[model samples]
Target: MAAAVAPTDQGPLAGLRIVESTAFIAAPLATMSLAALGAEVIRLDPSEGGLDHQRWPLSQEGASLYWTMLNRGKKSVTLDLRTEEGREAAARLVCEGDGIFVTNLPARGALAPEALLDRRQDVIVVTLDGSPDGATAIDYTVHAACGAAQMAGPAGLDSPVNNAVPFWDVIAGRTLAMGLLAAELERRRTGRGQHVALSLSDIAMETMANVGILPEAELSGEARPRQENWVYGSFGRDFETRCGRRFMLATVTGKQWRALLSATGLGTAMDRIGEAFGAPLDDDAERFRARHAIAALVQDWAGARDLTQIADAFAGTSVCWSPYRDAAQLLAEDARASPRNPMFARQAHPGVPPVLTPRTPLRLSAHPRLAAARAPDLGADTASVLGPLDTAGKEADP
Candidate 1:
């Protein structure tokens, strides 16, 4: 049974309702974004809290930090969707509201887009799959198939490097949110809803196409090579300071090159190196072509100065540079307990100590701020939302 509907949200999506039948990062993240934007998202989980609720990084008392992070600011209801009664209830919950249904579930089940659309003609059905035909492809597989895995990592590597971050899943999720919002607007304008289908594979391929690497390969008959920390075809490299701090430096223009040389007191060394190469140091293309030589010269200068001295030298220069910070260092210093980083906030949940959880990154000047509350316990809102619907399902089951 469903729980009583919560108070009406007041963001741009205020009064809008979304039924989320999704698991994992992409689908859930899409609904989470909508919820943060003031849509009342009702998440349908299984009797056992579903696969996502069991993902790792649990608390000492077996609470899922991963689930809480993605499912924030939404209502949760557990149902046995494998049964006819449960499927009917799921349809009822979706049909009764704003008629927005978002799911990554397989396209041929009770919760399929056709099933939901059949149940409510005006419902907006947004479904995401691994592929258009529903072949199983998560972000990692899609990333590999889309050529990103081969493009990442350092130069001269025989093997492809997988990024620690699942880039495609995030992109797909954000795109899905945009689609859902667009569908909502269209429905409002025409009083007609539509089915929106998206695939992680397609999303990755389209992004790569726009990125121009594949087009460049087709035109030049050469695949782009990995450049590691250096920007591809740009003047950039990671250098270590005297105190062993690492910094990634880049200079895109001749002025920035001159600024870098002046900032690091390497102008004379650069002039000598340029003379040796028979190239002018002021030409960005020439400097990039001689990047190895210039990098070596700058490394010597940077390696002799501590990070503090480097900062002082770079204070008035436009030689773009930033120190590399690991997760612990970043969290403990800049992102730790800072209001400027609106994505993170302190929240306490059952069976877990208060910890930092991520919130929606979107901020609205005209709407009430979305609260980053803890996710509900499994099936916690079942009675409130599906209460009357559950009874009706049983009464008609005969």
Candidate 2:
């Protein structure tokens, strides 16, 4: 019900509009991604806030940093969708600019996709659910069920290790963004709208299949053993330097393999080991088979040098390697994680101090990148959004 503001003449998605009602990761991330590309996203939450309003990684003032970062560049509108008036207002807004609606929450009454589409045939509705059958689920549960957790962590460990990152949720978010754009394109071409639905569990399962985990399990009749830091089907793992710092090194390509050998001065020794194994190390599978021997020499060479020396040895070479760093170290050391990178800017949110934030990683040759914008305080835009909605629950003319 907000007065329609003309989209800024910047970024690829300039003129696009999206109305979002979502919580936690996937749905919020999808809209935020579009917002970063210049879509005007209006996010609807309950009068107080949504379930993730106080999600952890909070600032000292108890503001949710997670929510702040995820909701960046979005206008916040608080509406008690449990009421008829609130739901009507939401439906009216959804049928406005671009006629797009996205949510992971249950839609009923006036907020239903069918009702919205009935109101405007060309409306695009995107919904994300935990499962096709409506079962309750989350990233950790999906990851465990998909068999990924079993294959993570140290080799020979008895317990399955869940990754700290919610990869499935992240993937689902990007997938939703892609599907939304595809739907928009289809609507533009045919002048018809349809609903786009996805399940978080499906994303995890499909990713496992795409990465060959399912086939490997089916063919081998066994679950994959945990690999720790070792790269699958290649020679890669972690090594410690004399300075007691650890780094991950991987040699997937022949060029990378050769570079590692050159950097470590172990070409002759590796060649001898390859001859002893009756196969050349140039082949990926062969290197994987002889990884223990290969890693031993590399580890010894690395252990004799400091982390700086190791970095110097591999500098400007095709040797793919990176030193392990915690979050603080990453912020302090990596230029890409700091304001030095075009993707990042330091910005303050509603109740949080200025922190390093990011714009869309996508670069458009035609449009200049937009600066990262702060998230609005809760319900900050409610009056602006609802002001134009007349008492009769209809949008008045601007």
Candidate 3:
């Protein structure tokens, strides 16, 4: 049976239980989505708030705004995973919880799930790291080493650029959620569980989307200098504008390509634009360039209009698209964030009003729980979580 909550919760994922022993974006995002959909997610963060708390965009109470943004929709329990006692305590919670997502993106000082799962056999664990084969140094270091920092751009820039966005982590988070759901379904059927691992490098490589990138040669040969706005894995896609605001334009065929023809007066019906969905981009450079030119013209059309009007224009069509948005812009234009009818609950934490956190996105029709209470202070759950563990420790264990 699903875990109990008020039947009025909004999302279909009501009643599932999840725990997060994560460092950064990927794991947090995965668990947050689950929480949005009505899963009970207990976020076990590091004792000192890990590497991000005091870093940037400070809260009034001085916690990192970045930290607040990613941690919505969950309860927090801070513990020292480096110590044996802490590890044991965490494993106990995982056993009680249905699933856990772990991030070793900063491949250093993370609790190893392989070791933790050795102690708890039935709990599902999803491990996220930066490199495919081994541990990563950190988010930036791993991308630097894997040539992602260089490949993030075009070939002319003098140096590599840190991807300001968590592209790898975002998609990997979705993938981790998928893996966990699949495992959860399997566990329900078989009364058994499995480990799911995702590497940030593998994810970055998978998302490169440029047709001309040669990873094997690029990694071993010259550290390819960075290039801005260049893609490597796919051919017929590029950025643009509809009436004025920026947009992404992706086309699949000469037919869908015709949509672009009508939208932007460039390219021909005779253009060889076969988008065999999984075809290699390097082999399709000519096709990409032909599309890129027309796409750039569409960018001009999009350059003058505001994002809202542009979005209204693309309401119907296979003109596959996206609008670039930062959090501030998102808060302003997104109907979900409207004060009159918000999709998420907004809260300013006890000491820091700058810690404006959004509630989980899941909306259940029947049993609707509001938002979780404010994030906890460090060791806030020590008594609650460790009490049973302490009593059991005094009793017995293998």
Off by over 4 Å in 1: 1-9, 107-110, 252-262, 267-287, 315-319, 336-342, 388-398
TM-score of each: 0.88, 0.95, 0.66
How does each model score on lDDT?
Answer: 0.81, 0.90, 0.61
Better of 1 and 2 by TM-score: 2
Candidate 2's displacement at residue 154, Å, is 1.8
Candidate 2 TM-score to native: 0.95
Output the worst ten-in-a-row residue range by lDDT, candidate 3. 273-282
Best by TM-score: 2
What is the clash tally of candidate 1? 10
lDDT (Cα) of model 3 = 0.61
List, residue by residue over 289-383, the lDDT tens digit for candidate 3: 54454444556666656666666666675566676677898777666555445444456653457323555554544545555435545546667
Cα lDDT of model 1 by residue, 296-325, tens digit: 888988899998898888987788987888
Instruction: List pairs with backbone clashes in candidate 1.
Output: 1-382, 1-386, 2-384, 2-385, 2-386, 2-387, 3-384, 3-385, 3-386, 4-384
What's the count of clashing pairs in each model shown?
10, 0, 34
- Tell me how far the alpha carbon of residue 86 in candidate 1 is from the true structure, in angstroms, after superposition: 1.2
